[model samples]
Target: MNILEIKNLSLAFSVGGRYYEALHNVNLSLKQGEMLAIVGESGCGKTITAMSVLKLLSPNAQITSGNILYKGENILEYSETKMRKIRGKEIALIPQDPLTSLNPLYTIGSQIEEVIKEHQEIEGKQARIIAKEVLDEVQIADSEKRLNSYPHELSGGMRQRVIIAMAIACKSNIIICDEATTALDVTVQAQITELLKEIQRTRNTAFIFISHDFGLVHKTADKTAVMYAGRVIEYANTKELFKNPKHPYTKALINALPDFNSKKLEAIEGQPPSIKEEFNGCSFEPRCTFRKDICKVKVPPCIKSENSDVLCWLYN
Candidate 1:
């Protein structure tokens, strides 16, 4: 069952009295206890799409048309007061930078307990016990002792674990991880990813994992979406997408990954179009190696194949 769905979501920002669309008719859904990874280079609208689901977009960002449905209810129409109740409780965000999300002045335990108290109506000793339990759940060593330390005292990996603990404390149905492991080392990244998988299996929690690392996505995500120029160009089951990538952009991204067996890396030529740049047809036409004349004249519709949906002339 789908826990969250984003239908025809188009988002734009106002710059110098003019509106420039960043996301174009984006459609995606997350199933219960599924890890859906959104992967692309920087500025590919991955983060913005996740932010839209949480109703945490910037003041200048406008959703001209779209419906963010959470549990069959359109949250776009919900008021700010109503959204506040759902934000942390129903949908939690694990940001890219844990330090910025955490407060330095307060102890880690206090911050987590605050969330428990606010959402669950439990306070004092009860809340602290819940907080410690969550910390232990995230595999933080000596959970009770670590709780007394401030955010600054912990290492980058520990800080991220604390953030994950907060999400577990809330028992959120959906966790939006916006490059949550980007700042950690390889070992720590693997640990955090394993922790997420464990949480999903135990709690049946759905996840929207945003990252530029295709290799990481391949390992942790059950399904994957490849975004380019603010649009999802290809989506499929993780194994299927990797075995037979259809879109040129998706193929290029996969080929670019470092392989010890391979001698050289194949990098995609040219840069992705900026959001302000208008595209007459397919935005990736300029950089695509197998571009056809029709690719410049008309946009390709999303075509469903055996195990994937691709937005390119090759598939159409």
Candidate 2:
């Protein structure tokens, strides 16, 4: 069952009195206990799409149309006051930079305990115990002693674990991890990914994992959405998408990954179009190797195949 759904979501940014759309009719859904990975290059609207779910877009960012439905209710209609209740308790965000998300002045335990007190009925020593238990659940060593330390005292991985622990403490049903492991080392990244998988299995929590790394997504995500120029060009089961990618952009991305046997990295020529740039047809037409005259004349509609949905005339 779908825990969260983003339907026909369109968003734009105002710049110097004019608006440029950043997202266009984007659609996504997250199933209970499933990890749905959104992968694309930087500035591909991956982060913006995830941020829209929490209604945490920037001041100038505007949602032009669409609905963000959580548990069959549209959260876009929720007032700030109502959203406040859902933000941390029911839905949690594990940001790219843990330091910025955490308060440097306060002890880690105090911060987490405050969340527990606000979301749950517990307080005082009880809240502290819950905080310590969650930290231990996230595999933080000497959880009691570490709780006394500030955010600056912990390593990058430990700080991320603390953030994850905060979500666990709140008993969040959904976790939005926006490049949560990007700052950590390879070993730490692997550990964090494994921790997320374990949490999903134990708690049956849904996840919206936004990242540019396909390799990481392949390992952790059950389903995958490939975004390009602010649009989801392809979506499919993770293994199916990797084994038989349908979209040209998705194929290029997979080919770009290093392989010992190939001894060659195929780089996609040219750069992705900026949001401000208007596209007459497909946004990726300029960079697409198999581009035809018709591809530059009109945008391709999504075509449903056996195991995937692709946005390209070739599929149509």
Candidate 3:
């Protein structure tokens, strides 16, 4: 089943008396036990898209148009009370920073127990038992001992594990991971990714993994979406997208990857445009190497391929 569906979603934030769109016509879907990665440079609307799905956008931000459906219901129509139930119970989010997400005053066990107690009918002792099991599942050494330890007492990796434990405590159907491993070392990042994959296998949890690291996405995601200037320029299966990127933006991203076989790395030129208003032309045209006159004058519809889709005049 499709756990989440986003169709033509756009988000804008009012800044200095003007509204700037952060995400434009973004469409994405997630199936059970599947992982999809949204990758782009900073301020490319990667995190904005995730935040919109969780309805945690900033006070100045608002959804202009489109629908965000979760479990076949339109979540955009949900009230604050209804959205609260969906936030941690049905749709869980593992934020990038563990220190910021965890409470310094609370022990790991207490934190996890609180989550379980909120949704499940389990009481104090039972919640603690469930918390320990989840902590052990994430491969935290000495789960019992670590449970009583506060977030500040644990190492970076252990703290991340605790965050993951709390996220999965309610067995949410969908997990939105926004740069979840950015603060960890490479080795620890790999371990966390592996743990997430294992959890997905065992529980059939769907994942929307957001990251700036293309290499990490290659290891974790089944499909990849390339975002540019608040819009998705290309999307495809991970292997297919890496092997053959049709859009100029997607091509540049792949070429920029540091490879052992290649000495020089090709970088994309120019900056993403400010979205104070919608642009009639392609947003990526300014930075795209293969941009033509048509690309500068008109927006291109997403052209379908056998294994992918690209929004570029070059494809037309």
Write down the lDDT of every candidate, Cα atoms only: 0.92, 0.93, 0.87
**Per-residue CA lDDT of candidate 1, range 262-314, in tens?**
75788889898889999888999999999999999898898877798889998
Candidate 3: where are CA atoms >4 Å away? 260-263
Shift in Å, residue 70, candidate 2: 0.3
**TM-score, every prediction:** 0.98, 0.98, 0.96
Task: Extract clashing residue pairs from model 3.
Answer: none
Per-residue alpha-carbon lDDT of model 3 for 22-136, expressed as tens digits? Answer: 8889988889999999999888899889988889888999899999988888999999999999888888888898888889999999999999999889999999999999999
Tell me the TM-score of model 3: 0.96
Worst 10 residues of 2 by lDDT: 257-266
Give the C-alpha lDDT of model 3. Answer: 0.87
| Candidate 2: clashing pairs of residues | none
By TM-score: ranked, best first: 2, 1, 3
